[model samples]
Target: MSTILIIEQVLNGLQSGVMLFLMAAGLTLIFGVMGLINLAHGSLYMVGAFAAAAVAGVTGSFVLALIAALAAAALAGAVIEVAVIRRLYDSDHLDQVLATFALILIFSEGTRWVFGSFPLFLDIPDALSGPVTLPGGIQYPLYRLALIGVGLLVAFGLWLLIERTRIGIQIRAGENDREMIAALGVDISKLYTLVFALGAALAGLAGALVGAIQSVQVGMGEPVLILAFVVIVIGGIGSIKGAFIGALLVGLTDTLVGIFLPEVLKLFMDAAPATSAGSSIASMSIYILMSLVLIWRPSGLFGARA
Candidate 1:
């Protein structure tokens, strides 16, 4: 199609990738550091979105909603860690998954009970609602462009947080040897809680940001959760750098294929068949990419050797 359209889609992919990074970054940290397979992490995301929606509705302020989202998600995560996840540390992935899956149901129903089955709406700030002219006569949404800037900022911030500070050192050490870190006088339990809460807060921020564009609903996190899982898996389970790169690769691949597959297929096929086939395969593009990555490197592109 048009070059402008391509550029727009690429931007969409970047936005989506940034959101996924927020989700996956927390997940990778939790898994790598705590050794906990938390299925309920997605629930934290929903909690953030719903909290933001409810607060914004009452307060009429997006900034307040955002703060509430972060607080709610972090509180929920810490509580869960104390009540449920702490016990699962020595347990198997199956038990962790089942318990967290149940948490997902609780979160969905709990949210519906409070907000009802109807979806909550979020409005973009007035300043960001207008379109801005880009290079080459392209006009784009200021809000979306803002999202890209926010995403890039978050990416850099996370890198600095994980790689620079003393806590970051502890997190990396915990990821490498949990027992060793524990033996060295580190309060590993507290560290785990902090990590979980941090992860939840990031997920919440993503939900709040995305809520402006999509409806704020109870089950909104599941789709994103799955995508985040795919992202981390492709990037390598415990690697932040890998997750960032993998997210970008996935976002671009998914958006480009979805937009251009039909046109490419129409070269040899009828428009109707091309459109249908292209749409179907486009949906499958990420999975196919995942399979290819796994086939060539099972541990992921940047995973440490087993």
Candidate 2:
């Protein structure tokens, strides 16, 4: 590929990584603090997209739509936590999984019933609707550039929250010793609700941002949700630092493989076969990388050894 093409792909990869970080960060936080395996997390993502789409359709304001997304997802998360998820904390993983999976069905059906089975659309804000020139004469989408900025800001904000604040201390403490914090009069239940809502808001933000690029439809969160799980696993469960690093690794690997592997293979085979082989191999690259990482460090790069 040409230098410009490579540069563009790199930007795409960064954008993808940032988005995954948003999702994985939340997933890790929720898992780390609550010790709950929530299969319904993806449902929160879908709720965000639908909320943004619906709001944008009526108000014609992207900012309002984003706000709606955050509010709707956070509200949904808190309600679910109080109504169902709170009961699963002391339960086994299988129970958590079954309950959340049932939630997935309820969310999907509820969404379809309210919005109809048709996909919704979100338009990029006019300010970010065009392409901009980057270093080395690379032209990239303005919306995507904005997304990278937003992701970085969120990452920094999360770092500040986790490392520099009182709530952060409570969160860290809870992660380390939930019972101790509860004994210390930390109102553990309220903290759990806050953390769940925060995580849900982050997922919602991701969904709203990505909805402009991809079609907003039912079950859209499943693919990204799976990728987010992989990201956290590779990064070390409950480690935001690891999640960021892992997300970048997976994003670059996926984008580069999908784009350039065929070109690399052309050197050894016919054009058509090279293309087909390249695509096939690229599809497995992330899983292969995960396997290799597990072999090297089963607890993940940053996770404490089990």
Per-residue lDDT of model 2, residues 150-265, tens digit only: 99999999999999999999999999999999999999999999999999999999999999889899998889999898898899888889899999988988999988999999
Best by TM-score: 2
* TM-score between model 2 and native: 0.98
The parts of candidate 1 lying over 4 Å away from their true place are none
In candidate 1, which residue pairs clash? none
State the lDDT of candidate 1 residue by residue for 1-306, as single tens digits: 788888888888888888788888888889888878777878888899888888888998888999999999999999989998998999889999988899899889988998899999888877689889999878888988988888889889989998899999999999999999999999999999999999999889888888888888889999888888888889988888888888887888888899899999999999999999999999999999998998988988787744
Clash-forming residue pairs, model 2: none
- Each candidate's root-mean-square deviation in Å? 1.0, 0.9
The per-residue C-alpha lDDT of model 2 at residue 232 equals 83
Poorly placed runs, candidate 2 (over 4 Å): none
Q: Which candidate leads the pack in lDDT?
A: 2
